[model samples]
Target: MKQLAIAASILGLLACSPQGEAKLSAAPEGFDDSYLQKMGFTVETVEASAIEGVYQVITDQGLIYVADGGKMLIGGRIYDITGAQPVNLSENAIRQMRQKDVAAIDGEAIVYQAEDEKYVVTVFTDPTCGYCRQLHNDLQSYLDKGISIHYLAWPRTGLQGSSYEQLKTVWCSDDPKAALTAAKSDKRLPAARCDDPVDAHFALGNKFGVRGTPAMVLPSGELIPGLVPADRLLNTIKQSQ
Candidate 1:
């Protein structure tokens, strides 16, 4: 089913409930979550907003707003301009969620440890993505800079067909790292399959709003949505620290 887009009309900071009462412990009693689920949204969280009656909804795709007890829905990011510096409240919440969700899959990732590692990054990648290949070609550059990279598969095409099957082979191989390099280099692999985390990794990538390959997740849970050079990435990490 085609997913519904966030309703444009409700995209701003609407009036929220009073302070203290503004925090939603859970989806409001009057809210009908089924309505959203039916619209092809995998809603992950619902929280009360600073705006009266408005609620912040986090979904696998991104942020949206709901109001009037679920009668209205708006899709977009919201910011608090009243703060000393503008705060993207929606992104902040999503970042926290992203951090938690990415961490949960650590055991399942294809990890390349950097010697004397100073930072770790999780990356959503597709074998067919040119930029992903570019990053892979310079994989050691990141390691040289003391950045460990944990890779998660994210086929642009849905979990079916050649790409998915190829990634599955990489995950199932006796030497997954070698298999991955071979696949990314456009080499065919010996067919293989087993219980693997490719599906879970793909799902997690979607939940974190990964629209394309080479999406990098920093230790701080901030997402950088492209192939960043090792030196540039190292600088970014240092600046964040």
Candidate 2:
């Protein structure tokens, strides 16, 4: 299956500050993330983690934690275990980033607008994937429930293949929606090219951590990584409000 990938390192995010207390950051402390450059990561921003000394380093690729003035790299999420149910502080930070990224590319997506249009969800999809095709096939079901679908291309094989070319044709087509439908049906698309958003969409999906096709970004910026039924997705959107 193909996939797309988020925004805090899901945009370079600010430190997660505790409620009633101001947020602290590592940048002002002159913490050098130049060490990250040695590892080939473009350092976007660095912020203080919920942990006392750990800093969340937001990079062009994704989020990572460092400590001891960038001497240590912690490759896992931070959780507030003090709560009755564990809250993933890292995930929360990334979600906010996703919201910004989604907004930036809002109109570029291939959309299926509902009549009432109660909710909008951005989906990073690949016509090459079975689940993605299924989701496309159920477009009317989703639309009927007032759920509008916006599709972003994510070829999933890292952008160099027939699949990527096929998807590009869809975005570059005179009638993108029809081309997309044809592609999903395994019909060969006539080769076409333009200033298509296909490549940009793929990169955005990768940043959003789309590991597979049919990754849906809910209205609240939370990423749901699979094919979901229309009725259930509607309920989810309502609950998120």
Candidate 3:
């Protein structure tokens, strides 16, 4: 099966909910793991949000918006009704969660730090991706502009076959940056073995709703997917600041 289909299959299992009037909680009772399972949520953590009558729930599938009592689940995006501009509540929630989760991954990431390190961004990369190769080539340009790049693996082919092995080889290299450059330049690494964090990174990328390589996560939790030029990226960082 394809990577997208495999991801969707995992989500399908968590979509099965009991057929009945779903109850809502009056107060935040926190996330009840068993209750969430019964209601078809592969529960991970539930967090209180600024919005009343709503809770941000993190499940194995991804982030979801649910009512206080865990009724009326919204799998997609949510918007704030009372606003001059339409505020994407779901996007904001996901951004917050992304920042928190990505922060925890700082130490684990293969980092390409800038000398000054004015801005920090996390990239979900796949070795086999063409755009990812382009991005890797311009890594120095970003560094020159004081942008620190952190890499997290997101194999386009998921945890299987040559794609997985290639990523493992890169991660296992004594100098990962050199390994990545060689791989991107069509010089394949020799067959090697090691216990790699490729699976963990792939899982995290999925949780962050990363459907493709070269997806970037800014410090403010906004997602920018695809190959963004160095100048444009600098402008974005400035705007966010």
Clashes of each: 7, 12, 2
Cα displacement (Å) at residue 112, model 1? 0.4
TM-scores across all candidates?
Answer: 0.84, 0.82, 0.80
Q: TM-score: which is higher, 1 or 3? A: 1
Candidate 3 colliding pairs: 24-69, 25-69
Deviation (Å) of 92 in candidate 3: 1.8
Give stretches of model 3 more than 4 Å off.
1-31, 38-41, 49-52, 81-83
TM-score of 3: 0.80
The deviation in Å at residue 171 for candidate 1 is 1.3
Q: Which lDDT tens digits does candidate 3 get at residues 1-241?
A: 2543433553442222112333333335654444455544456667665567767777645676667476445445567778788888777777887899899878778899999999999998887899999999889999999999999888887778766778889888888878877877878787666777787788777777787889999988888889898899999978864
Q: Which candidate gets the maximum TM-score versus the true structure?
A: 1
Candidate 2, residue 113: the lDDT equals 98
Candidates, ranked, lDDT: 1, 2, 3
Better candidate by lDDT, 2 or 3 = 2
**CA deviation > 4 Å runs, candidate 2:** 1-29
